[model samples]
Target: MDTVETLGKYEIKRTLGRGAMGVVYEGWDPSIQRHVAIKTVPLTDVDDPETQEQIARFRREAQAAGRLTHENIVPVYDYGETANVAYIVMEYVEGPTLDSLMKNQERFGLPEILRIMKDLLAGLEFSHERGVVHRDIKPANLMLTSNDRAKSRVKIADFGIARIESSSMTQAGTMIGTPTYMSPEQFMAETVDSRTDIYSSGVLLYQLLTGERPYEGGLSAIMHKVLHTEPLWPSQLSVTSPPALDAVVKKAMAKRPNERFATAAAFSEALIAAASASAAVVSPPPEDATIIESRRPVAGPVAQPVSVPVATPPKRSMTPILAGVVVVLLAGAGGAFFLLRPSADVPRPTPSPTVTTPAPIPAPAPAPVAKPEPVPPATVAPVPVVPRNEAVAPAAKPAVSPAMISDMFAQITATQRCAFIGGSVGNNSEAVLTGIAGPGARDDIRQTIASHAVPGTMQWNVANADTVFCPALTLLQSIAPPFGSADPVLALTLADNRTTLHDGDHIRPRLTMPNFVGYLRVDYIAHDGTVQHLYPQVADSSGAVADKVHEFVPGQKVSLGDPSAGQPGWEVAPPFGTDMIIAVASSRPLFTRPRSTNVETAATYLRDLDAAVHAVRDGGGTLVGNALLVDALAK
Candidate 1:
């Protein structure tokens, strides 16, 4: 790899990091006399369709972040291209990612965790309000910077996977998030809202308190646990944990989106309350009783509504009335007795005592000694024994033959099996399936497969796909036609009518656009994730002069005249796989600038293209395009 000293106005000091998308460098922006982190991916790598889409998405989110003015979010300052390399310049903060910090520290103290959660949720609330969803909010993407006055500040980084609420950039049914941090809905590949972030924040909080992730396993196992298993209470794992915190965790991680906190603000509020209650007698609420949610049936029969019986107040007792009457009579009798007794109480009597002594003792012990008899010889009859009843054993179920089990599995419908590909049963009835495609009732699928494989001996394992997979977008996302008319179509042809090409092979891309005269920009994403502006590079490599934006007329054909003509023709390069060539045409000028040395400089150009396409549908102007997929060298 060649080390470059400069990219646009910035001096690349050294490489900071590199990933599948591109490389990040510590750079010095000479114009501003400030340090910056510059990220760039070479044009040669962007040629592959996957790489193109990925890099494009990365730039798109950078542009989105550039629009935000939040202190908690990593800021995007500038975007440009130089020497066929696209670069995004961002604020260079000196800090370690939370992931790195967590490695050295076990569980964060309550104060530390509270501060982090508050700052994190604040960033999330700001981003969510602005309609930007940071689909990936893992610990690694959070930067913790220390300030002189404040303990630490959390900055959310890496908006490469973020999506604007209004933009449908992500195709439907695509799963785009880290599975461990993903919400149940995300795992199901269902539509996600900001509550998805709440669930992730809950997982993050859980980890901070317990020093372990809520779910840990292989991809499929993780997915299963995230979807179904409730995390162990933090108090159970960490002795220092406050019991009151469990309610907050339960609310944030409620399996259903509606069950989770309504907003990041709400989640933050709960955390603050729990932290403040550290000293009080906090019998906050029963976990289930806190929210008082209406009861819903869960894997049980629906209970019929019952009318509560009303009770009448008890009648006053009559025993007290009878007791009062008896007391009055007794009192009257005592008064009469007292009046009669006074007259005869004057006389009393006296008595005397006498004493006497007499008696002789006689001895007669010998007579009774011989009367003892031998009456112990009588035998008692044994009681008839009664037998005890024993429990009856249940009959054994008939064993299912291996052939019958195989046929049962064969009978499962493709839909019932969902995206399971090929399957086979081993001698011991261990069934292995090639892969599972989308999310579905995995438990049911396993049961169905087992029923047909070897009922009792059956075991299931996923082969190709270890986790649920989302379908890739194959069709070009293009502008719809105006006024119900057919969209302007563009087609590409290889000189040899072959989709695969080798290095040093020159191929002419024949062009078509919306049949009307309009501005056209022809671009190709190379396999290395580089964006190549093919046409109108006649006089300079940066781009064409202002007037050369192509205009299309019906039945007008465009082509690369010969291999010798460098402009509008592509010579295949190395490190090739799949590449996509797209032609965008709109009635308005798409590029605000005349030249883009690389794709980062072209982001605004692409963004304007998308806006134009959308604008045309709303009766503003016309925009349309077509895409061609070509295979370059395998490696």
Candidate 2:
């Protein structure tokens, strides 16, 4: 086996990265007097014929990547097998791994991501020509080094799982790559070619643009989604994603492998085009007026006319002037007859038979010279309603002060974690039950919105940024009676209670509570499909109870108040406790077929939960309480 400390003459300095195949180590090579990346695979990895075959496959990948000596491709220097280990030596580059970059930095602008995308494409093209496919392309396997953060050069790394056309390694039906970024074909164990890598790069690119991963759920859940579900478009995350980028991303991640880019080079080219198209959408840079002025010849300013010579006033002939006035008066009267009269020019008056004028034997009027004719007046159009995200009519007044803006954001974020998780999945307006917007997430989303908005108000551009800020500022503006800015907390509390819920409200995704003590499920009546999931709930859980649903299953923790089959934590908790109560009209959904495995049922159950939510929102009056109170009154 190739030892770690010194691989032949190279002294291993430290571990660079580790994987199932081998460990990458930073090593000192005396011959080159420079640091080099050395990978050592111990014989234990391929102790038998099976591993040995895989190692042979590794050699083919190394060769394919080795031939790709581009700046973005990790260049290989040597490859060999010792005992049960196979080792690869390559040039050492000083930069953070793409994985690290992503982990540290949540997102990058389109321009920055495109630069990395292009570099990756060129390297991929170099490998694909030799019929090599880097099936496991993820952020961790990429490296970046640069002076400018936006223009950092990216290098593709870890081609250990590279698939070559002739290689007889990596058997079918065996899941190998990261499921989050894996393409459907890889999940199916189908023959993966270059297109598979393209799909993965698309996923990677999406992640870089949106700090969140494209798919959600556990490993198995992700695999199922990758194999069956379609990802939401990047534009959904934020409107900032250019339409062109969205198209390219969609094409690259198309469910049908054939629909994806044919090659990495093709993907890169498409990316380039998308970026160019996005740039074209922006206005051209302003031209310098100085240049325009220089081009124009200014003849020295015209001299002002001094009273050089005033012409003598001309005298008019009295008889002709008087006759001319009479002629003008007659012409004006004659013109008014046709101009204001409702003859042919205007519609006839409704009242008829009042009087009829005799037709005059008039001159032909030069036979009425025919002209092209005038166009009809255009009808007035109603103005369109401005979208909530778009700027409304210009602000009546300047924005609130920065201090007020900060206070508003802090107010909402302060109580971010102050959310409820009393119901099961589909609770809290039918969102995923058990979502823990825990204080952390609540604080994060609130702060994120404020961070974008406060500074956003400083500019007139930025879509929806000002809108979001306006409403939030308005909420803050109404916090207290006129002069309550001095005490921001009371104002915020007042605003929180009075303001209608907007999308930005700190309505955290409810996480399942640890203790749902003393809750008893009174009953549930659910159909095959309905948004109203749980209703008329009661629980024994004793504490500062939010609603009756919490009292139903005191020990059973629920994420949201809503409950359904696909609900994560709502399943029959393995062995149902005799003491625990989960009352339901029908446990199984009425319909056998669902929209998407369980979406119909999820929506159905969310509806059932409306009663509990209403009770909480309006007043803590259970359906049972109303019936009992009414019965007492009747008696």
Candidate 3:
């Protein structure tokens, strides 16, 4: 076989790499005047079934990768086939593969490892939600755009064996994918799903953390270990690895898909929580001090008292002059008691003492006044009087005025249509901004808010929106609830792990309350601005309850919209755009009774929810919330 000069309009410059199936070339796109990587598979004897299947798979790769558009994914620009070869042009990245870097003994710090994992998981999450599973998720398939740890960016490649939900190119009994990174189900030649990629990602994460694979050896040996044995914990293998991450790895690589994290987002959240826990351990706060874990600095005046030790003065003998002075002070104190005594006609003002004394010397009594009213000695002697001229100081001023914050939010809303920005004052005297905005708008929004607010007094709970047209997300942001900075007590995920669904598609919401033991209320905000209560159906006599974990009993995980469980799922409809699913977990029931209407305007429902959340907070009950956004596309 001879190397060709060009494939379609792409002019081949040099061979980049070659594999058993095809060769990748560094090509130039004449029209775009940019470099592109052209991957070509040679076509021989098209009538042969093996050749025909290979060509089908080659085209499938193009279709699968073409459907995805994400920053972390290598996008396919075009796909074409000549008489003797088929090629796909992709965005050319200039860096080594993760496998090559690992082989070269690249040492990745915890932060770098986390960054890589986040990018990988984000790309996987997006692909999984769209019903595409990259059957081969190995270090070899992950490309980096830079060698510098801080600047390196991960892009997933090689979708030749990817299985799209709507495609039946791969059969269940077929064994495909790299052996070392294959999931247990994949090795067993069983039907694979998103969890399959999760298992492979777990392998990659393990390698990144411990500098070794969980199972290493020949095909049969690796299979046996993956099927029946547990690997050493990452913390054991790597001294710097946090022990908390061990459980995350175990869950991700569980033999059964049911035991794994349901979605990539869930897995990422768990990893972040573990990382945070590790960070807290490394830098513990001072004793007798309140620790407020917040995403932003708390604004306002803070009083930090400093203690100073004073030396005792040298002993001195008392003289006749000192004795005379003591007598004078005793006479003055007696006169003050009479003048400061409360009268029956006037109410007594509360005393505010400035200093505390361990003991007091007895003073000489003055001559008795004429018809003196008897007063309690305990009250008169201990209470210190404040001057009538001095008034109590007013509370500290906020970092930024409320009007200024409102004006900033208005400006942000005007420029960023997909953004929903809201502001409030926190208990710690900081100005808190909570909402969702697209990636492109986040920097501008942050800068705008920073200009009007104080540096240390501003906190944020604003999450970056994955898509630009998220109306339901904007609604959730507008109704921003005060969620604490601690790990979320509850989680809400779509059953399919999808953020988008086509019209007529059934939507299922899954709620997990790992540590929460209380009442649960789930609500659905449709694209059309209507809200519906999914849990605690109007006919049900009892409210939804999430039981806590006891000995041998796991925490609650409820799945809605399952017909086998006798629950109906919400179906996608017209007025397609973004929708939201919200789950509120509380120690007590949010509402006293079920909702009367089947569906109501989002404004009405959100108002009721706000009242319920307030009531729960006022009652001293625990409250936490989680929400997911879904895009309803027209089929």
Query: Which candidate has the highest TM-score of all?
Result: 2
Q: Write the per-residue lDDT of candidate 2 for residues 460-555, one digit (tens) a residue.
A: 010111111121112111111111111111000001111112211121011111121122222111111111112221121331112222222211
Q: Which ten residues in a row have the lowest lDDT in candidate 1?
A: 326-335
lDDT of candidates 1 onward, in order: 0.51, 0.41, 0.58
Candidate 1, 213-247: lDDT as tens digits = 66653344355446544655665444345668878
Q: Rank the candidates by lDDT, best first.
A: 3, 1, 2
Error of 3 at 344 (Å): 99
Give the CA lDDT, 0 to 100, for residue 32 in model 1: 79
Off by over 4 Å in 2: 1-4, 20-22, 45-60, 83-85, 146-151, 279-635
Cα error of candidate 2 at position 248, Å = 1.0
Best by lDDT: 3
lDDT comparing candidate 2 with the true structure: 0.41
Residue ranges of candidate 1 with Cα displaced over 4 Å: 147-150, 280-635
